[model samples]
Target: MSVKFRPLADRVLVEPIKAETKTASGIIIPDTAKEKPQEGTVVAVGPGKKDEPTTVQVGDKVLYGKYSGSELKLDGKDYLIVKESDLLGILG
Candidate 1:
């Protein structure tokens, strides 16, 4: 509970949980385009924004829009930086 994210206002820098090896469409997406993918592992989390505080935590797996967030790489791993509003919902 002591951990925190460097969120800029309502924007949350999130790292989405990784996707399955095979996509839901049953297609294997190549690596290059996958760099800016919606799938990733949640490593860090931001505190929250005004009004609508972030309901997500560091370990929650979430599904975002196709062109949802800003993609980043940490330790050669891909991550997504999305606004708290961009998050659709927490996946079960």
Candidate 2:
């Protein structure tokens, strides 16, 4: 998964990972009942703000706040555009 869209300064483009469909009890959860995933793969990144540079890279998998970004679609796929500060951490 790669995208040609590039983010401006301090902004990042993320491809959100879908939430789990099954619970621990083995119940199959429907899409309408599922929560939006907080984790995502970094698809594109901005250069930096004037003084502060973004720590995340394009390929990094990151955790962000649940309601952090604005949703957009590119090539029929969903993506989020969030500020670097909205990102919580990078996944190992």
Candidate 3:
């Protein structure tokens, strides 16, 4: 996917991965009870601060703090703009 937005100064644009809607036992979870996903796919990345370069890259699956990042909508899709520091780690 091509995103028109680009983050600047060590920030990242993430497309949140939706939390599971069903349990292993086949129980359906309600929206009100679902927790925000702490994981997402990196959709866009910014140039690093003067000295440091951003590490994450687009298409990288990553883990982040549950409360990290600011939420926004693009093309009716939800996204998060977080600092590289807010990212916990890149998933293998």
TM-score, each model?
Answer: 0.62, 0.91, 0.97
Better of 1 and 3 by TM-score: 3
Worst 10 residues of 2 by lDDT: 1-10
| Per-residue accuracy of model 1 over 1-92 as CA lDDT, tens digit each | 22244656555556655545667889887766464446444455666655666677766767678898777666655567887678777777
The lDDT, on a scale of 0 to 1, for candidate 1 is 0.64
Q: What is the alpha-carbon lDDT for the whole of candidate 3?
A: 0.95
> What is the lDDT ranking, best to worst?
3, 2, 1
* lDDT of each residue in 1-92, candidate 2, tens digit only: 66879899999999999889999999999999999899999999999989899899989999999999999999999999999999999999
Better of 2 and 3 by TM-score: 3
Q: Cα-based RMSD of the predictions, in order?
A: 4.3, 1.2, 0.6
lDDT of 2: 0.94
Candidate topping lDDT: 3
Clash number for each model: 3, 0, 0
Q: What is the lDDT of residue 62 in candidate 2?
A: 97
Give each model's whole-structure lDDT: 0.64, 0.94, 0.95
2 or 3, greater by lDDT: 3
